[model samples]
Each structure stands twice: as C-alpha cells, then as structure tokens.
Target: MTTLTYKADHHWRFSPILWGALVVAAVAVYLIFQDGVHLMVRWWQRDEYSHGYLIPLIALYLIWQRSDVLSRIRFDGSWVGPAIITLGLVVGLVGELATIYTVVQYAFLIVLYGAALSLVGPTAFRIIAIPMLILFFMIPLPGFLYNNLSSQLQLISSEIGVAVIRLFGISVYLEGNVIDLGGYRLQVVEACSGLRYLFPLMTLGFIVAYFYRAPLWKRLVIFVSTAPITVLMNSFRIGVIGVTVEYFGEEAAEGFLHDFEGWVVFMACFGVLFVEMWLLLRITGDKRPLSEVFAIDSPQKAQENEDTSARHLPTPFLSSVALLIVAVFGAASLAERQEIIPEREEFVTLPKELGGWRGRVEIMEQIYLDTLKLTDYRIINYTTDTEFVNFYSAYYDSQRKGASIHSPKTCLPGDGWRFNEIETHAVDGVTMGGKPLIVNRVLMTKGDRRQLVYYWFQGRSRIITNEYAAKWFIFWDALFNNRTDGALVRLVTPIREGADAAVADERLQEFTKELSKVLPEYIPG
Candidate 1:
C-alpha cells in the first residue's frame, strides 16, 4: 500500500498575489458580518435556535480533528471555486435586498465553501465537506416553512402524547393540538413543537457520524435516524408533562421542574444516540468499544497537524476573491439606499357598507396585534337575515423585512378546526376586468360545525391564489417596482345545518364581485 505523510513544515506558502487575495476575502467577510449580526441576536432571543452559537465552534473542532489527513493532501486550486463564489455573491445580494436572513446565511456558507476550495484542492474539499455542511443547521428555517412544520409537528406530538397519557390509564381527549385531561387543558403552542430538540440533536448526530469508524451506510443510518428519535423523545416529554400536571398541579408544568424535565429529556436523547452507536457496532461485528468507535484526535497528533498546510497560487481564485469583494461593497451600498414604497389607501379606511350588505368591524386585542406585526387589518362581519359572511384582510405596506402575510392554512388548525377538503375555485365573472379570479376554497369542521372559507392574495397589481406564487411575486415586484405591498383577503361563512352548499358558494361569488370593485381603492391594485 502507498502511504503518504506530511512532516512539520511551519512556513507560509502563498505568493504576493495570494496574500492580497486573503485581504480582499477578509473585507468580504466583514461585509457579510454586518448583515449577519442579526443571527447572533436571534440566537440569544429564540430558544429553539440558541444552539446557533455553538454550531460554528463544533464545526471548527471537527475540521481541526481531520487536520492530519488534510495536511498530507496536495493543494491545486480550481476555477470552479471562483464560479461558486460569484454565485454566492449574487445570492447574497438578492437576499440582502429582499431582507431575508435565511437566504443571506446560505449565501455566506456557499461563499465559505468556495473560499476553502480555492485555498486547497478538490481532495481537501471532499475531506472537509461534512464539517462545513454541518454549519447549515445553524440557520433557522424561513417563517412560512417554519410555521407549517411547527403546526404539523405540534399536532402529531399532541396526538402521540395523548395516546401515551391514555396508555398510563389517564383519561384524555384531543382536539387538534389541544389536550384535555378532564380537568386540566394543555395547548401545544409553537414552543412545544420539539424543533428545539430536533435542531441540536441533528447537529450532534452529524458530528457523531463524522467520527464513527464505520461503513458509509452505517454512518448515514446513524445520521438519518436522529429525526425520528427526536420526534419520539419529544412526544414522550409532552406525555410525561401531561401526566404530571394531572397528578400534581399546573405548577409542575410551568415552574422550575418543567425546565428541569426539558434538560433531562435532552440528556436522554443523547443517551439514546450513544446506544444507537453501540448497537451498530455489535451488528457489524466490529467488536470495538463504543468510545473507540467514535474517537477524536489526540493532543499530540493535533499539535503536529496544526503546523502548516501547503498553498497554491491560482489566478482564478484571486480574481474571484476580488470580484466577491466588489460585490460585497455593492450589496452594502444597495442596502443603505432607501426603497421606494408605493403610496396607496390603507385598509383601516375600508367602508363598513359595501353595496347592500350591512357590515360591523371587529377589533383585535393588543396582544394579538403585537404578535401579528401587521401594518393594518380588518375583520368585518357582513350579515343578511338568511346568511352571514365574515370578511378579513391583513395588509403589509412593505414586506422587505420579516413582516409579510401569513397563510391561513397554518393558522386554522390551532383553533380546533379540522380541514375536510381544500381546493382552488375559479370564479370567472367575479374577477377584475373580466379576468379569471382564482381563490383557495376550503371546508373546515369542528365537531358538528362546518365553515367554508374563500381567500386569495391581493398584490400590488395582481390577484394570486397560491401562497408560494405570492412569495415569488413579492420578490419579483420588490426587485423591479420597488414595491412589496400586499394583502390577504378571506371571506368565511358558516354552512348552517341542512343548508345547501351551492347557495353558500353563490353568495361568496356575488360578494367577491362587489369586493373586486372596492379592493383596488384600499389595496391599490
């Protein structure tokens, strides 16, 4: 077998041009940090993402542990690194303009990977890829995806928790994400969605997989199983909390013991991860101890490997670095320039009387208003002797920041409503200028009560049906017209017992026709 080794060589290997490139790269990173400081703020404030602070430290340690192998590899930079660097810069620019931190963070990681490839060769890139990729777990999911996932996970965890409570001979009833233990009620809000455990455990799982001296498939299995393991353990935590609250008082679920239980559950998750590693060793007949299976570098070896690495002088990498620096300055300048928000009528001025229907405005509580973070909104109920329709609109003047319209699909289930069916309904005559107007038609039920809801996104100059499409248009319009104004309009009417579904549909269509006429003045289509 051919054996390769690196003797301790502590001298610098970069040429004058490469040294200049290094300075440019540092400038680029400083620009990125200007925008990325918010992530640090979020790490401190958001409990679920607090692990963000530790991710970089862990990733760095992993990369250091592999130093011995990386030092021996030859360095030949590739032009592909520059191409990737340019892509990352462009993505970062877009993200900064759109004011979406998730996109900006992804662009930052991509740029870092490109920089690594430019500093070393493809072999070193492959060796350090896992540790680099593990850094991704630090970026929080976008609001829309987070809301959808959190809502689903909350429901699933609640169901499993209630089932577990019953298994322990405690009578329990589940309504959506609400668990009723006859006397005490536990509502599974977004905080208890188990994402807190999932994010950190997945990060730990990747680190374990990197160190485990096993086959490729075995490593993947150990990594992939973290998700299911997190879900199961989190459900058990909720079940245990419910049982405690039933036996003791509500204080058990809220005070110091509650926090103590969370820590215990997290420790149990780690214990389970170690047990999994042990089982895999037994199955593969490796006969190695669990500690040895996932061993790290010794101090002597790490010190030896930390001496220095050979460097290459590549024109493409240097050129890419220069261009990236230029792009960073450009993005920073663009961020400083004020965006032109279009002047339009506000939803607060919406008329109470639309055509013949009598309307009454419903005011929201200050707490809900604060949570929604909307610019303006209206929740008006229009009624006739035979039927009642509720109209709601949430408007955002500038969606450049984190503020934007939320999808009702994510919000509906939290209030004990189960969706029976959802589909897009096309209304031909009800559209503006005789164009086809598409809206989401949904049927939701709770116990024996049922409601039909019709909703659509009213953008600057277009009416949209799909939520994803609305996001695309928001980005597009924000880019071109410098306008990110949009609003969500929803009309809901209850289907009375023994009432015909067709009649309710007709009533909504007729109301939408009148709505199309008055929406433009307020929403400015």
Candidate 2:
C-alpha cells in the first residue's frame, strides 16, 4: 500500500494596477464621506459614544485575525459590488439633500461594504463580514432617536433604582424620574440613565460574541445580555448612592465618590458578562478552562514553498472605483450649495403686549442657551386678569449640521415632567397660510402641578404638529427649496388648584390665537 501526503500552498499578491486603483478608491471614499465621518467623530466626544474611537481599530484587528484564511482566497470581484455601491451613493445623495448626516453615515458603511466585496469577492468577503459589520458600532444614533431613548432609559432606571432604595428600608417617593428621599431629592437625570455604560458594554459584548466558539443561540444571548446587565448594574449603583446619601450625607452622590462608584459598577458589569459566558459553557458540559475556551487565535503562517502570482484587476472593482469617483464629484457640488436662511424679525422685536395680555420677557439661563444653540429665542410670561400663559419660541437659522429644534416630548421628560395626555388639536378661528392652525396639545404633570401645552413647528410655509412630520418637511424643503430653517412655537399655562382643565386649555387657545398672528414675521413661514 502506497500512502500519498498532499500539502496546500498559496500566496497573497496584488498587481501595481490594483494598488493604484485601491489608492484612488480610498481617496474617493474619504472625499464622499468626509462630512458624515466628521459628524461621527464629533459625536464620539460625548460620553455615550466615546467608545466610537476604538471601534474601527478593533475592526481592523479582527480582519487581521482572519488573514490566514484570506491569504488563500483569489480576488475575483463580483457584479453585486457595483450595485451595492450605486445603492449607497443614491442613499447618500438623499441624506445630503436633507442635510441629515446620520443617513449619510449609514450610506458610508454600505459603500465600505461594497468596496470590500469588490476587492475580495463573495467567497472571501464572508470570512471578514463580521469584522466589516463591527465598523457600524462607531456611528452615533440620530439626535431625535438618542433623546427618545435616553428619556425612556432614565425612567426605567429610576423606577428600578427606587425599588432598590426601598429594599434598604428607606422612605422614598418617586415622581417621574425624581427620587424624593424626604430631605434630599435625587433626580435621575440623563447622565444617570446608564447609556454611558450601555453603549460601550454592548459593543464589548458583540466583540466577545464574535470570538466565542459556541452555539449561535448562546452567542446571541451573550450579546443581548449586555443591555440588561448594564441597566441592572447602573440601577444598583443609583440605589447604593441613595442609601449612602441617607445614612452618610449628600456628598455620597457627588464628587469623587460618585465617579468612582460609576467606574466600579461598570467593571462589575464586565465581570458579570464573563460569568455569564462561563455559565453558558458549563451548561453545555464543556469543562475546559474559561481562558482556553474564549481566546483570540493567531493566524497561521503561509508555507515557505507557497506559489505567488499576480492577476489583472477585475472589471467589477474598476466599475466600483469609477462610481466612487463620480460620487466624490457629486458630493463636492452638494457641499457648495448653501441653505437659504430667510430674513426674519428678531425675537427681541416681538410685542411685549398682545391684545389683553401683559407680557414680561424672560432671559434664558446660560446653560440652556449653550444647549439649545438657537439663532434666536424668546420666553415671555403673559398674564391677563385671571390667567397666565408662558410663550416660548426657538428659532434656528439653519438645522443642517447637528443643531436642531428639540422636541418637547423628549425634553419635558428629562425635566421630570410626565406626559398625561398628548394629541393634535386645531384652533377654531386660527389660520396659518389659509389652513386651520393645528398644534400638539400636551398635558404634562410634575408632582402635584399640571400644565397644558400647545406647540407646533413652523417653517418653509408649513405648520407641523408631529415631530416626525417636521423632520420629513425639513428634509423635503432642504432638498427642493434649499431651506432647513424652522422655529418651535409653544404656549403653556398651569391648571391652578381647584380649576378645571378646560380653563387652562382656553387660556392656551386665546394666547395661541394672538401669538399666531404675529408668528409669521419671526418664523417667516
């Protein structure tokens, strides 16, 4: 009997033409995605997304880890690559027209995927797909979505934290997101919403799951468990703070101790994730040590006698590169197109007295002015013989970059106000541009006080009540009319003790009627 042994031999080689094409493609991609990339980098400066800086490096490392398998795969590009690149370019154009960088960021990722697929083709692309997907973790959520999520997490964490505080036999009253500990009220502000931990931990979990050699279901569980783990750990930290503050002092919840506690809790969350992975392994009857099971395997080196050869550049890859070059030119043209900021009267010129109401203009705090980033704003308290209404209007000369009109639905909750009721309501006798003036009517409560609010987004010859509708119109007008300027007009009044809600509603309607008449000069709709 004769036994024959066969050894596999392969080598990685790229022709000079392919290298030149790659350089051109890279420059084109950077030019086309520079705006979105810059936006993402800016967002990374924030606490919740600081992890963005490390994601790309990790993706590169992950791809490097697969170099052994990649070395053997032939670089035959696919037609699908150009199709995907075209699709990404189309999406990017829409994003640019709308001045929404978040959409553009997603399109950048799609184009990157297409470029990779074009370079390596389907057979090898599959090997590095997860690493490619890991790049997505670098992008931040859109402002509107981030605000909504932060508000929801704040409420959830507050409720759980309050429950934890009760476990220590402390008397605590929960109102919206506030934790009233009789003397010291702990407001569960956006900072304590656990997002700072959640985002980073989720990214870590995803990376861990990718490396974990386990059943698919088990890997998913490991990845998904990060969210709950973060929430629970953060809530527990808040509870400990509450208990410490009750026994020690308010200082327990501030300064060094507060920051240190956060660090500890985050570390504990990581520990918990590891323990979960161990438990999962044990449950599956795997007795190997945890370190041995979960590890980064080094890429195997190519044999010394491996054959090295160079092939011509694929047509599909050339097509993808050509598409990117055209996209870069298109993007440059769009960048030159300036938004139309219509001339409007300053908020200072708004009437101090309207009809029967006497108005007192109030200055916003420096902190709020910094946060809002509005071109102009006015806050007036208008009072009549028996009622008072608070009038607020925030104008943005342009909402193209990152600055935008904050929706009350997100802002109110962060201020410890809970929405009791919200709906669209049309004023009986008020008209805007020959149409009935419609507004978002909101009844919000904070502790024992309740307030009725009426607000609408006025811009580009449109009065919009829905926040989403406002965004859509901003996109539409930005594309067609070269305008993304808008203002949020809000009228609010308290429902006094022993007063009917209808009374407050009537006060807002009356104030809105007067306010709408003069709104055009300021909002320029």
The most accurate candidate by TM-score is 2
Worst 10 residues of 1 by lDDT: 1-10
Error of 1 at 43 (Å): 5.8
Candidate 2, 45-138: lDDT as tens digits: 9788898999999998999998877777777788899999998988988988888888999999999999988878888788889998988888
lDDT of 1 by residue, 1-525 (tens): 013323344423456666777887877766764565566446535667777888888888878776766655555667888888878878877876766666877888888888878767576678788889988888887767776888888888888888888888988888888889777788887767787778778888888888888999998998899888877887887788778877887787665336744556677888898999899888878898877778887423435434554466666667667777677767767766566666777777777777777789999888557546788899999887766889999888877555668788877887778879889999758775345788899988999898889998987778888999998898888667777788888999898877777778988887888778887777766
True-structure lDDT of candidate 2 = 0.85
- Please identify model 2 stretches exceeding 4 Å from their true place: 1-7, 261-264
Alpha-carbon deviation at 72 in model 2, angstroms = 0.5
- How large an RMSD does model 2 have? 3.2
